[model samples]
Target: MKICLVGSSGGHLTHLHLLEPFWGNKERFWVTFDKEDAKNILANERKYNCYFPTNRNVKNLIKNTYLAFKILKSEKPDIIISSGAAVAVPFFFVGKLLKIKTVYIEVFDRIDKPTLTGKLVYAVTDLFIVQWEEMRKVYPKAINLGGIF
Candidate 1:
């Protein structure tokens, strides 16, 4: 299946990279907001740049929506898997609207409480996963899939 990986930079990117063993030469694309992470990932494969605004203002939300629109039209991915902050929010929302299967994996560090992205995306995601089973107490629908990376 054609899969799009979405996340913010740093730990999120690192987390997704762990799934490399499941990849072949070219079945996936990445969507992220970090310049350094983009540079590193693009050294081998192409990726989509989701906007990372300096201000968390309305303008930034608009930009993210536009970016999501373009990506949905261009990529037409069958599935979207995300380790999110905020940029992945629009993509996941658009993915659901487009009838694509959406999967959101909660961050490893967030065992005590759900992250904002996790809580918001839970309603739309086709699959919601948590590394720790403890998270299931809060979100019973979530799959305790262990860790992806």
Candidate 2:
């Protein structure tokens, strides 16, 4: 199945990378920020760079939404998965509208609190995965997948 992996740079990207074993052999491409770590790690992989300064930036959110819709339409991914920062929001939203199955992994660091992106995507994601049991309290329906790393 074709998969679209989406996430931001730094810790979010690192968390998603830990799932390489699952998607590496599959037909998958990535949507992430243009950062040194992402560049080095995904050097040989197929990827698309999303806008930076995400989160609260209204201008980039609109731009990223357009980019996400364009990518999702062309890629025609069967599933879209993400471990987010902010960039994943548009992808997940657009993917949902396209009837693409979405899986969201809550960031590993936020054990006690919910992330803004996490809260937003929770409603639309088909499967919500959390690393810590404590997170389940916040995302009651979330399945504790232990830890990606």
Candidate 3:
């Protein structure tokens, strides 16, 4: 099945990469920022660069939303998975509208509290995965698969 892996740069992307064993062999591409770490790690992989100002930037959010629609239409991924930091929001929203299955993995660092993106995507995601057991309290329905790393 074709999969679209979406996440921001830095730790979020790092956490997603930890699942390479599971998704590496699948027909997949990535949606992430064009940063040094992302560039180096995804050097040989297919990817779509997402916009910046991820937090509260309405302008980039709008741009990313448009980008999401285009990507989803062309890629038509069977599933969309993300370890997020805002950049994954548009993709997940658009993917949901397109009836694409979505999986959101909570960031590995947040154990006690929930991340904003996690909260926002929780309702829409088909599966919400948390890396820490304590996080289960925050995301009651979340499946605690432990740390991806």
Give the whole-model CA lDDT for all candidates, comma-separated.
Answer: 0.81, 0.92, 0.93
List model 2 lDDT by residue over 1-149, tens digit each. Answer: 99999998888888888898999899999999898999998999999999989979999999999999999999999999998978989999999899999999998888979999999999999999999999999999999989777
Can you write out model 3's per-residue Cα lDDT over 1-149, one digit (the tens) per residue? 99999999899889889898989889999999999999999999999999996998999999999999999999999999998989889999999999999999998889979999999999999999998999999999999998777
TM-score of each: 0.91, 0.97, 0.97
lDDT, model 1: 0.81
Listed per candidate, the RMSD to the true structure in angstroms reads 1.8, 0.8, 0.8
Please say which candidate is ahead in lDDT: 1 or 3: 3
Candidate that scores best on lDDT: 3
RMSD of 1: 1.8
Can you write out model 1's per-residue Cα lDDT over 1-149, one digit (the tens) per residue? Answer: 88888877778787777777755554888878758866786568768777776235567668887888788879898888888878778888888888999988899888869988888799999999899989999789999988665
Off by over 4 Å in 1: none
